[model samples]
Target: MYVLIFSDAGGAAALLVVRGCHTALTAVVSNRSNGAGGNFFCEYDATHQMSNSKGELVSIRALVEFCSTTNCNSRQSTSANVFNDCNDQTTDYLLGNEVLNCYECTAQQGKNCNEKDRKCSSKKYCTKQIVHLDGGFQLSKSCSNINVLGIDNACANYDVVTNPGGVAVHNKYSQCYCRNKQLCNSGSSLGVVFTVSMLLLVHVMSTVVA
Candidate 1:
């Protein structure tokens, strides 16, 4: 004879086991019981049917007896279940893609440098460029793709010759630091005069080349 007692939301339900008729009694109790849905008959007897159940229930007796030695009816968990109640609703707009945000400004001595935030388009990179001149330097920070300055590599120096005439004009630009992170190249220490000089130099170079 076996007695099965299981707990449910309302309360506990019981089943009466008759010797040599365990299977019939278990099936009847399970079908009539008002509680969770599972094949508990396997736990009610030592000899259980090899039915295609959840594979958790081993013997009907084990379930009916609630054997202290055996660990049955263990709770399972999953990623969704664990984080189901999380309140953080933050979503990534880029969805794992790179966000190239940069600070944009030009060097200009004795002049006010207008720094602004520039949201780079997709497939673009942040750049911090510095151009050395006769007695000053020009600095520009913005977003550009690999083709803008023909920078095949990050932070590599290069030269741009705008004019090659009687008085040749040479422009040397230090490696333009490129990065994939957002807002990585926003700040620069070069004075406003430097930016102004750089712009003037660029204008003159363009005019000479023309």
Candidate 2:
């Protein structure tokens, strides 16, 4: 697997692990002008950037990217050598293969954002992320195509927004869903969360009383 983990000063970094699949490494690009676009770099095609219909250059505020393998993001796998095995190339989109259509969103300050389609590559998984913060939360869901080598549900404290000009707020991604089927991450996992948290709270209270 080819892993690339880039950390931003604002704390918006991702661990991407690409294996034998042939798909471009694409990202949801947003600039300071509040413009949104897509950028991808692939082996067969030259690196390309997408802009709004007006074709203006905008400053990048945040970028969220991913890959299929979970090993790339593992806690113990923190090494720069993760990208040692990757070049550039994409396998042709196969027919009848499970091309996932996932719900995609990026939000800050607990405000909701527009949801769109995220057509995933073959053998990829759908992932959902819910970030919990002080008295509020943010939500995002997308496709992940990566090999699984270890546990997927791990958490770390990371910042999401660098600027706090009432535009974006930083939050920690607290929940993740990595599933193989299409649209598996479309539904919210709130019920499970409430139950688990309640149980933990009860246990803690009991321990305190004891």
Best by lDDT: 1
Per-residue lDDT tens digits of candidate 1, residues 1-210?
A: 223322221222432222322223222211212112232211221222111122121222112321111343232222223222211111121324655555655554454446553344432445566665554666665544321222222443445444334344556655343443556555533221111122223433222110
Write down the TM-score of every candidate. Answer: 0.33, 0.37
Q: How many clashes show up in model 2?
A: 8
Score each candidate by Cα lDDT.
0.34, 0.33
Q: Against the true structure, whose TM-score is highest?
A: 2
Q: Write the per-residue lDDT of candidate 2 for residues 62-157, one digit (tens) a residue.
A: 112223444432322245543333222223222245454555555556466566434433323345555554557556655443212112322222
